[model samples]
Target: MNDQRLRLDLAALADEVTAVDLRDRTLRTSRRLGIQRAVATSAAALVLIAAATGTAFAIRPDQTAPPLPADTPSVTATPTPNQSPTPTPSTSADDPSGAPPSGGSGTNTPSVQFGKLFYGPADVTRVKTAILRSWRPGGSTVQLLALPDIAFKGNMSVSSDGHRVAWVDSNNNLVVADADGSGKQQIRSNVDPYCVGAAWSPDRRQLLFRELAEPGGPGRFGMLDLRSAEMTVRWWASEPAACNAVWSADGRTIALTTDYGVTLYGADGTKKRVVPGFSRDGWSTDDVVSLAPNGSRVALLRRNMGGGDAGDVARDLRVNVVLDTRTGKQVTLPLGGRTLRQVYFQTDGSMVVRVQAGSGYAVLLVDEDGKKISETAEPASLKDMQILAVVD
Candidate 1:
């Protein structure tokens, strides 16, 4: 946990941060009003405030390349939906090969090789290794822990309970270490675990892993039951839809999406309802946004039926939508991205959201109707860091 100073500015569009409709994923603001003061997106049914800064955006491969090289991304983007139309929350955002976007003039920095970063306790940089002599930082007084062999490279994922952490080491081993960096046990796998990503059950007892037991064998799907220490492979490819397996917090039905749309399945693989029109149809698109404690109201990233943000990329697109999961009838809100990620709802139906904005993340406790009450950050040590979780 290097005490490196991370300074970010968000003084562009200074306005009172407030409520956003949870129906669409668009904003109701503009980028020309200088730097944004702060965004107010919440964890549950949050909205966005897209303000395109003059700063270079990571140009898509399909988009016309910017003359200047790209810089280290301050953001992560999901790969574009495959042309084949598969359903899954866990698909690589790029193409079928799971590649990152291609565009470079030596300045293309995707922040891939700096090392898997995380909020290490508070902010302390000290380590005592038994492997080698005293490891030190670049002759500077600042403390550093450089365990080259114990590499935690690639994508790092923290469990929902925030206790265990799983990441791929340089050797492609799926390693689960204690949040306090104590017990480090490596799970066996040949392919990089981070490549396909790993999903821990709500109880963290089982892992729904995507792998092949043998090189020439078929891709394996299903549970690595910790309780029994057994591997129960399912007869499903798991992809072309997205999620490998998403267990309910209590560990019951696993809801997933396929090439067509979202579906819920029993623990024994009994197919439930195939959520309709999650993909684009008649100008409507929906994605499972949340699973409340009661499992009654499932939040969705719902796009409008007849709306376009062609001219206003910042403020004229889709909004968040909340659905009564039991019945298909839904209630749409005009939420935007800047504030969508700010909203957070508990299993008890209570929610909190950030009221102010900065490049650095800080959560604000809000009232029921999306009103801000306080601010808190998502425990991190980097600058402008927003944590995105991937469940395979």
Candidate 2:
């Protein structure tokens, strides 16, 4: 919501935009060409035109960091997988014996201080509840109400301002609401409840979501124009296929991973760039990408082989790799010994990855140079935590 304006010269990239492969893609040709004009605007400040819905607000070049809610917590990160961590007894500022602190006595109280954090809470359960934690604000913990009747299927995305969240409800309805758990609205209904992907644009003006008609059924990708109430389909798979939809941090690009490599698309659903390398691996319930804030780099979690029991599958599986989407350059993270589950990008140009540790999951902050910074406290359930947002 920053009023700051960034003027970009789109004329230089106009040729590249037009040269993108638009041959046999699923997006409509007329619509795609129209979007190219809007994105490659010759005006002073590049504009976004949502056709018929009018123009979305001029997107500021710099993304604003999400705000810290009153209940944010301070956190202590655990060590790497090889290190044997010594159990540190919990202590309070008022007491030296590491005994329980007074004041709250079971009630939730706001922490006095906080730090920069990347948050990912536990998954929603049948009890409609999950535990929320902070990576930096010094380890405050709270229980958040999971949306009614839905276990979080794939990912729950928090907008840039940290005020709104978008997820799929148990009914397969795309739900948007305030972060404080108010103003719950189901934007899309009567679709498949097995929704897989949900993400918010950097400006928080739109959302990208995908769902299937049923298990192993056809997949549909749609963009919800928050300001104009327009739902546009970017692509609809003819047969059953895995869809991994990722919106760039700059709010201008979207990447969809099919059995092939990643297909890059414009904000208006036009095909932009296609960088092929990803395997035609089997469809995973957790197919995703962690795009850098500047839209330069991306981290992908490649699924290895596993079957039979769930525990056995989780034990020996998966590898994460960071790739420069433009040059096809990649750097593999040193997470070979652990089961890497999820990956995300922090605003500081670092990577926030969630890895399976023991019976739970730990959030690791990795720098842009691909060095491990620290690992936060492990959550009770590995299935619960997915990096939601990063606050600096």
Candidate 3:
């Protein structure tokens, strides 16, 4: 009932009933990327911590705060429906190497196709501060800025064009800045500290995050429009037991992982369909649901919690399941028998999938139909690195 008691009980329950996915843990602990790792290891903790810390200012139906006034410059306009949603690189006067800026241009520069990967140290507990870095897959990593450790715990997000990044800081303030860590702006201060996820809208003008309606309460979803600096709360008619939100590439639909399954909603927040049996109840995490670019399908990491035997746990958790959002049918992936660790959808409908190799993992670019396009070259050591955003 109490937060401490609940955390202890959940830890005990985890030890008794949950199987630890060693590969998943290794990837998460080493790379410190993906929300699934958090869901797998700390879902219960996140819920309890949120409920505990947010009770004092939990949102009430009648007491919702008025939208904060816009203080920062408006975000770039959303791309037209006919235009590509991928980001073009901006000219940076700060960096001569052509690397992304740490504090250079805003969003006003001319657009050209730009590709970069943003990632950083996964474990910042010891250091207190986390350093974010940007690098091409095979190129040198550039140090961006040092941020609070909380910024990386399912709270950090990179824009579709890989030009911007957003995260929640230690004080529960939502901050947005450029990919190289420049032009920092604090959008929302004192947001629910336990909100475990943040996602960039496809057009890159807004962000999606989880909100709690009350202290120690159920979950609600909200969107922050950078262009207007206004917050919109959706799913107000009902509360999900637990959830995480993601946007479709077209910016037309939003998908949420819930205790019941994955639910789809239009941009206007109207429920479209419910893909049941993919709930986050037993073994789902915040990073499990990734919507396709076209908003027709969703990729889910459905962990196969092994039998009662402890020895069987690691092997069972490597399974993955993707579904057709329209039909709620399971779709098979052409993985060539490699265990799928995680899957992320790109703006073009293709996916970058992480699969288990002998002691590490491999990244593959795959087509919409599940055909492998090519394998990406990663750095020699991924020990504390995580791929935050990708633009091809």
Candidate 4:
């Protein structure tokens, strides 16, 4: 196939890939500062739309892409129960089931812990409560804590070491606690009218959170020092605006996304440099970007924009590209037919991806060269199964 034809094919396939998660869409539109919410990676529903006079098509960052299909049904499944040999959170029979794929090992000691958070039935009786759980990847799970029914628009974050979890509590306090819900403590009260995003420092001793100045309005970023129990604004910008921040594994540099591009910041909140060849355009409004374990690179998903009827636009496409933080060089892996849902970089530079599977999704580890390392069996329930941190 010609290069042009191949581009068209990839774009079409990308459009067809769908995973419905309302929280992701809300963040893209709202960009509240809090925890990383799960993005949708549902089913394949590709359609080809021919380009029109006003439509521009390009595979570069900062360009508009196709929007996700409208009204994609939300995923609803009863979390199946599983047996675990390790300690796990308290779970009811109807709780979401989580365990390593079969043949992985029933007694495998987990090097990493995964966080699973679920909100209630959005169908008839609105159960506004939220539940958070922690589990060793491919192992057993332990219930962390549960929040009484509240507005479902905020965020929850877990530390890279997987030993700590944080979120905004009912009293609008920034709460940090042990992964298993022990030693719970409030870090800051009324940190923001809405605490929407939170990220831990590499050492897990500090955290940066985004809080809306007002409901659904642009907000500033703040940092919390756990030892001192002090919280202060991080000076993310001279003015309040939406930006996404992630810390390097060493905690020396922070990658912050702006309307222009990605910026690096010193731990003391000093500006480093604007990353070349990295544009904030074409990304889902929420900043779907991840820092490499070494902090020298980043991976960001394209914000797909669709136009024209399925017949006129002729295409729908999306991609995840890795950018070199130092040189701003980018690498796009040829995933073939895989629909990306969640992505994280390992300490050795390999990438672990969660992609769409039959009615659900599965986890796979791939090398930098786009080669598959290993993949776990498809879990029976993906509703609340979220991979929070990876330990190799």
Candidate 2 versus the native: TM-score? 0.55
List, residue by residue over 106-152, the lDDT tens digit for candidate 3.
23212211235555554443555667666553344556666655565
Off by over 4 Å in 4: 1-126, 135-137, 147-153, 193-196, 210-220, 229-242, 276-285, 304-319, 326-330, 334-336, 368-370, 383-392
* lDDT, each prediction: 0.34, 0.45, 0.51, 0.46
Question: Tens digits of per-residue lDDT for model 1 on 278-343?
Answer: 544332332233343223334434554445522232111111444444454563322323444422
How many residue pairs clash (N, CA or C atoms closer than 3 angstroms) in each of the candidate models, in the order given?
A: 60, 13, 3, 35
The TM-score obtained by model 3 is: 0.63
Q: Per-residue error at 31 for model 4, in Å?
A: 17
Q: What's the best-to-worst order under lDDT?
A: 3, 4, 2, 1
Q: For model 4, how does the per-residue alpha-carbon lDDT over 178-270 read when each residue is reduced to its tens digit? A: 655676787676544222345666566676765545433335666667767355445555432334465555456666654445676766667
What value does the lDDT take at residue 192 in candidate 4?
A: 40
The list of candidate 3 runs beyond 4 A from truth reads: 1-115, 122-125, 138-140, 211-220, 229-242, 279-286, 305-319
State the weakest 10-residue window (summed lDDT) of model 3.
55-64
Instruction: Tell me how far the alpha carbon of residue 97 in candidate 1 is from the true structure, in angstroms, after superposition.
Output: 44
Residue 329 lDDT in model 4? 71
Residue 51 CA displacement from its true place in model 1, Å: 28
In the predicted model 3, the residue pairs found to clash are 39-285, 55-215, 102-180
What TM-score, over all chains together, does every model reach?
0.45, 0.55, 0.63, 0.59
